[model samples]
Structure formats: structure tokens, C-alpha cells
Target: MTEDEALELLIPGVKSKKLSLEDERKSKDLVKMLGYLPLAIDQVRGFLTEAGYATSIDKYVDVFEKHKEKVIKPVGVVPNAMVQRSNLYTTFELSLAPFVEAGNEPALRILMLGAFFGLAPIDEAIFLEYRKVQPAEARPAMPAQDPWDQIRFRRTVLSLAEQSLVKLHSQQDRFAYSLHPMIREWLRLRVDTNPRSVITWRPWT
Candidate 1:
């Protein structure tokens, strides 16, 4: 996003006023370091706003830079789950924590499966088929006699979409989904560190 766009997003509902030269420079530098990504920008804005540091964009930048190297490190390669310690990574994790805490394993499994696929639109049927063959432990709490049950599957997918972990697409009468690039990277790091996570990259034929 351009400086103007980032400014508008960061300071919503504010009247137009000329920023002091120093503030302008700090805003630009902050946006650049945020990679122009809306998610990260919004998180930073929220953090600053909540902490009464909205006017201290430069200070936030300093804090961001302090952890910048750690944030850029490959996930799962680092020990102790500290990969999530960075602000941006923590933002994503907080978005995901509710589902895990709720024992929504089906939704998490669907997310993990999508992450295993590249960050591209995946056919919804892929998840359904995978669920069908997965062992009892891997399946959601659907009717045991109904191997083709879709109630739980659809619910889980929609829940994931609501969380912004995946984007839903419609084509003709069918549906597909894609994960955000940052989310894919986070999941990849999780899979790398988690030896027990089930993931496969083979195209569904």
C-alpha cells in the first residue's frame, strides 16, 4: 500500500490535516517495514492505539525492528515455539487460538491440509475426500455410519473462512479456497517442527 493509503487505514475517521515532516517520514518508514500488508498494518495500528502510542509511530518502528530479525526467521526451525513471539506472528496465532481452545480439531485439520497444498485455490472436494479416508482419530465427530457426512466438514470450512485463515471462492456451482501467503508460511513452520502432523503435497487425482 502507498503511504497515503496506509495513513488512511491507520487513522480512520480522522480529518485531513498536514502531518509534520518528522511524523510523515516516520509513517512512511513504518509502512515500508510493515511490508505494505494490510493485516500487519492493522495489527500494528491496533497495538499502538490500544497502548496510547498512536502518535509514536517511530517508537513502534523501533520495537518492530528489535524483533525484526527473529520475525524473519523460518518457523519451526527455531526452538521453544518462539516463532510466535513476534508481534505479527502472534497476531495470526491469536486469531487461531480460539479454535484450538474450543477443540475444533476438524477446522484445524482442514486448515493444516490447505496449508500443505500450496497457497492457491484448492478444490473443496479435496478436503471432503481426505476426511473420508482418514482414520477415526482424524475424523470429526460426525455420524459414524455416515461416511459421507458433510455437515461437520462444511461448518469447519466456513469457520475457517470467518477467521480469515482462508479465502473462499465460488466458480459455477462449485467452491474452492486459498490461504494467505503469510498463513501458509506459519503453517509450514508448524508442520516442520511437528513430526506428527499429517500433510501431503500429492495432487488429488
Candidate 2:
């Protein structure tokens, strides 16, 4: 969407009531800052219209500027993809902040490792294999003698799905999940940021 379309989307009633000149300008700038992507726009709209985020466009823009760098940088650029990778990364990073702050390593590990699998709907079994061999640091904290099990596995993966970081697919006998391609790239970028935290491996054959 163009800046005008995004502004209207950000402010649902823009057509009915005239916004102040200052507000109109700031809103358009905010839309541009969000990379003019509708998903980013909608997420920012939620921030503005809802509680617990910046109260106004000015403050929200400030928040985005401050935290954007905290998101891992995209490693390789793709030309003219429908979604801007930087903004998508920033948007999801902000969404994931609470989990990170809470130190939910299991959920974060599941999300990061899932990206290593190709874009196909990943079979749950591959994640089972991952849990067995992932680096000690990357593995979720649990008792040394206790084994990770199916119930715990589903809980962690479901957490990622709840955040929209991964798409969950349910079949009659099992569950599978996949990430959006760009999001997969973002996750890989995250993994690349800290080499010691990840173990090298080929994507499942």
C-alpha cells in the first residue's frame, strides 16, 4: 500500500474526520518507517490503538527507531521482495521481546532451529532429532537425567505458533509447521549472529 493507503489503514476513520496537519505528516512518515508493508502497518496500528505500547505515532516511531537495531540484521538482501525484511524482522522481534526477557529458551530454540529446515511443512520428527543433538547451550534447560518428551515438545512449538513466528499444520496423526520464507531468512540471520550458540548441520534430507 502507498503511504496514503497505509495512513488510512493506521487510522481507520481518517476518511471521516480530518486529522491535524502535524498528525497527517507524522502518520505518513510512520508508515514509511514501517516500510509501507501492510502487516507492519497493522502491527503498528495495534500499538497506537491499544494499551501498553506508545501512545501516539511520534512515540511509536521513537520506540521503533530505538529498538530496530536490536533485531538481527538481514544477512543477504533479496531484490524487491513483497515484504521488507528489515521491517518484518523488527516487527517480530518486538513481538518476541517478552519471551526473550522471560528467558524462555526452549521456545526460542525451537523457533531458531526450525528455520534450518527448508520451507516445506517441517515434520515434527526432525525437531525431535534436533533436541537430541543441539548444542548444550542451545538446548532448553531441563534436568540432566530427565528426557524431553512429546508433551514438552508440543508446548514449545505451540508457543512459537502463538507468536505467528511459525505456521502450524495439524494432520490426523501428527503435527507439522513451517515459517514464511522471509521469516526463515530472518531466523537464519539470527542464528548467524552468534556462531557459538549453534551447531553446524545440513538441513534434513
Candidate 3:
């Protein structure tokens, strides 16, 4: 979708008369940075609406500019699919923000680990095994005596699936999960950009 079309769909009753030319330009820039995806645009709209004092298009544009390199990048099979590539990353970050903000360590670790496993379906057993071998310091602290409780790990994975950050696929009696390619790239970018995040890929035994 074009930036204009996305803006109209995301914010009903947004008219040219209500927005100044500079604001319109900033809105367009924001939309472009978001890859003109309806989902991403809607996410930004929700964030802005919630942040009443900081709802200006200009302010959003400034924020976008700062992280544009990390969030915006081209990736797709088809030519001219750069924007579509960006759509997934932009929306993925929006979906992930809540977990990060709440400091949900289990959920964050699940997501970060999932990204290392590639975009294909990841067997649930792999994560279960990882939990068994994962060091106590690696696991999120829990109220229960066992920090690596399997039940808590399962719940965290399910929550990530519910948020659409991970796609859950079931075949026959077994279930596996996968992340969108864009989301995997976004997570990789996060690890690369932040010196504090420690992510390592290890074969599932």
C-alpha cells in the first residue's frame, strides 16, 4: 500500500486541511520508514494515540530516523519488495516492545533464541532440551524453586505465538514454530547493534 493509503486507513478522518504541509511530509516519511504496511502503520497509530503528549508526526519521524537503519531494510524474493520486507520488521518490533518494556525475560529469551534457529519450523523439543542444559544464570528467575521450569517456558512460547511474533504450525500430533524471515533479521540486527545482548546458536542435542 502507498503511504497515503495506509495513513487514511490507519487514521480515519485525517484530512489534508487538518494537517499542515510540514506535518503531511513528516507523516509520509514516517509511513515510508514503516514500509507503508497497514499493520505497521496501525501499530504506530496505536503508540501515538497512547502517547498523547508526544503524538506529533514530527516527533515520530525523529524517532524513526534514529532507528531506521536497524528497522528498515530490503528483503524479499520479488523485485521492488523492499517496502514489504520492512513491513514485517516494523510490526515485529511493535509487537515485541511490550515484552521488553515489562522486562519479561522468559519471553525475550525465547524470541531471541528462536531467531538463532532460522526462519523454518523449530521443534518444541529443541527448546525443552535447551532449557535442561541452559545454565541457571541463562534462565529467567522464577518464583518457583526451579528457574528453568518447563511449564513456564511453554507458557512464554505460547504467549509469543499469540502476539504473532512467532507462527505456530502443527502437523499430525507434533507442533513446531517459526519466525518470519524479517523478524529473524530484525532480531539479529538487535543483537549486532546492542553490545549487551548475548546470543549464540547451538545444535539441539
Cα lDDT tens digits for candidate 2, 75-130: 44342453376777776776666667787766676677667777789777765675
The segments of candidate 2 whose C-alpha lies over 4 angstroms from its true place after superposition are 1-32, 36-58, 70-83, 129-146, 193-205
What is the Å distance of residue 130 in model 1 from its true position? 3.8
Candidate 3 lDDT by residue in tens digits, 1-205:
9766877855667774587777677777777766677656765776665566365777665665554445543322232456566555655665567777887776776677777786579876765565578765664422222534656756776777766677777778666778777677666655532353465322112
In Å, residue 155's CA in model 1 sits off its true spot by: 2.9
**Candidate 3 at 72: error in angstroms?**
5.4
lDDT score of residue 24 within candidate 3: 72
Residue 18 lDDT in model 3?
Answer: 86
lDDT of each: 0.61, 0.66, 0.62
lDDT leaderboard ranking? 2, 3, 1
Local error of candidate 1 at residue 95 (angstroms):
1.1
Best by TM-score: 2
1-205, model 1: which lDDT tens digit per residue?
7777877666664336677887777777766665566776666666566557654787666656655544445342452444333445654554565677687766766677677677568876765576568776764332233465566666666766655566788779677878777677666665432355545222112
Which candidate leads in lDDT?
2
TM-score of each: 0.56, 0.61, 0.53
